[model samples]
Target: MTQEQVTEFFHQQLGTNACLEAEGYTIDDPPSLDTFIDSYMSGQDIWLAYGSLPVLSQQEWYRIQEVCPQP
Candidate 1:
């Protein structure tokens, strides 16, 4: 999905509590997965990833799982 789509999903799921404490920043009005990825790549903070991976390619699903381990 696109960054805008991801952001909208989080906005719905997180509501007012969407801000990640560990990340020390509230999600932008609309979260951008690309922006989040950039920050994470730079080691700025952990990005919250939310979505279903079954629809993605095997490699993509594995990568997402690796980044966000299941509880």
Candidate 2:
């Protein structure tokens, strides 16, 4: 993605994170823009909120995703 696209994607991810936090989920620190760019550009797996949170059952996970879909 272009720089602007990448930046927008980051903002979306941040918004999702904020929503999850507001729902009382623990969130891990997010990566820097540079790091996110590097990983995204290289096709590496980007860190996601669900990966950072404690394991949840399939139903709960789906519910949380409904509240905060991944960016």
Candidate 3:
């Protein structure tokens, strides 16, 4: 994935960075393109320092297949 794809995937999975801030989570600006692609392919749970928020907060891949209605 490109940096754009990585960023979009992040937002798709975990909403906007500002939305996260509203929920009390702090996220740094995304890194370089290659870095983002690496992270995206790593299958790692990229951590955001969100103390005091509920531990149940989670994210999933925002798949396109579930969006458009079928005929």
Candidate 4:
């Protein structure tokens, strides 16, 4: 999605525009979702999604751990 769309999505998902703004992100000039996801996959700390995956099934959690192991 476009930058503004991605920023709005994050704001809605995170329930706070201020959080994103505090991180030097603006809804008017946010990065694309694909870029953000790519950075996340590459272990860059460009974004944070707090409490978004609290209820992952056991198997799903294990699979995620396999893909992105803890330090």
Better of 2 and 4 by lDDT: 2
Candidate 2: residue 41 Cα off by (Å): 1.6
Cα-based lDDT for every prediction:
0.45, 0.85, 0.47, 0.51
Write one digit per residue (lDDT tens) for candidate 2, span 1-71: 98789878988888888999998998998899888888888899886655677888999899998988987
Off by over 4 Å in 4: 1-15, 18-28, 48-71
Q: List TM-scores for all candidates, in order.
A: 0.27, 0.79, 0.34, 0.31
lDDT of 4: 0.51
Cα displacement (Å) at residue 35, model 2: 1.9
Residues 1-71, model 1: lDDT tens digits: 45565456445444423323233333434346566545545667533434312266888656644644432
C-alpha root-mean-square deviation, candidate 2: 1.6
As a whole number from 0 to 100, the lDDT of residue 13 in candidate 2 is 86
How far is 69's C-alpha from truth in model 1 (Å)? 0.7
Q: Count the backbone clashes (under 3 Å) in each candidate.
A: 0, 0, 0, 0
Better of 2 and 3 by TM-score: 2
Residues forming the 10-long window of minimal summed lDDT in candidate 1: 16-25
Q: Candidate 3 on 25-65: residue-level lDDT in tens?
A: 55666455456557667965553323223444234123211
lDDT of 4 by residue, 1-71 (tens): 65576555655544343443454444344346677656645676655443333566889667655543322
- Quality of model 1 by C-alpha lDDT: 0.45
How good is model 3 by TM-score? 0.34
